[model samples]
Target: MSNELDTLLTALYVDLEDRVLPSLGWSRTHRRGRRPALGDAELLCLAVAQQLLGVASERHWIRYARAHLTGMFPQLPGQSGYGKRLRAAGPLIAAVITELARDVDSWHDVLRLVDSTPLPCAASRETVRRSDLAGHAGYGYCASHSRYFWGFRLYLICTA
Candidate 1:
């Protein structure tokens, strides 16, 4: 593997192992909160490995595990279990991602691209009728877009 790829993998694995796994103390030893069947570390590692391999969607993720992750992980957890594990760790995962900052030395020091995107919060018809954005969802109105979009506006940060 290239040095960059190796560094990223090592950083990701170590971050998952040390920072992400410990916060998921949702379950009790006496099973008060109900333990996730899969270990937190295994689930995170498997999901990240899938993401690194560019596998999206839960079904294809299972196929990826059957092909690549199975040999690496003796547990080789099932798709359903993986889904549950991911759900349990969702907030922590997002927090970890948000906390990660770019390493300036690792950067190219050339042109930088900073952008934004729409992260819609389910603006379906019924959703519109029930949401605070109901009045805002229509033609020619988006506070964030500053223009007409057929859907509700969203805000997110992007960087490259």
Candidate 2:
């Protein structure tokens, strides 16, 4: 809606279409079956925009996009369709992220920052006992909260 956001989206879409998608060998004609109304680049742009706008729920994002971004994205998919496309585009998304990160100046920096957060898988003792994550997940203490949790640690490392 804002001028800055519109500019950002435009620039992002151009970069994706001209550089990222082609480099990944993802041309519009490569896929089989009926062509989607939304192209891969456009879908990826929408995904990035959703993240930038902090719209977490796919249903809510679809509603918001339909209301606010319809001018930019004329043909929008339904919530379920968007979810399926997003799930299927996971590998493409990862590849794009990698490619984009490589272009960032700090990506090659030696200095890095590391963080770990608790990803709670279960709360109840019974649930923990029956959960399939028994072998992979275990009890851990979160120093920040001064509490114990039954989950796996999610670690994130980023360039400084």
Clashes of each: 0, 0
Listed in order, each prediction's TM-score against the native is 0.48, 0.70
Error of 2 at 86 (Å): 0.5
- Clashes by residue pair, model 2: none
**Prediction RMSDs, each to the true structure:** 10.3, 7.7
In candidate 1, residue 14 scores what lDDT? 75
User: Please, what is the whole-model Cα lDDT of each candidate in the order they appear?
Assistant: 0.60, 0.92
Predicted candidate 2 versus true structure: per-residue lDDT over 1-160, tens digit per residue: 7888889888989999998989989876966899999988889889988998998999999999999998999999999999999999999999999999899898788987899999999999999999999999999999999999999999999763
- In candidate 2, where is summed lDDT lowest over 10 consecutive residues? 23-32
TM-score result, candidate 1: 0.48
Candidate 1 per-residue C-alpha lDDT over 7-89 given as tens digits, one digit per residue, 9 for 90 to 100: 66567767666755444342236455666545555566676777777878888888766775454466766777777778877
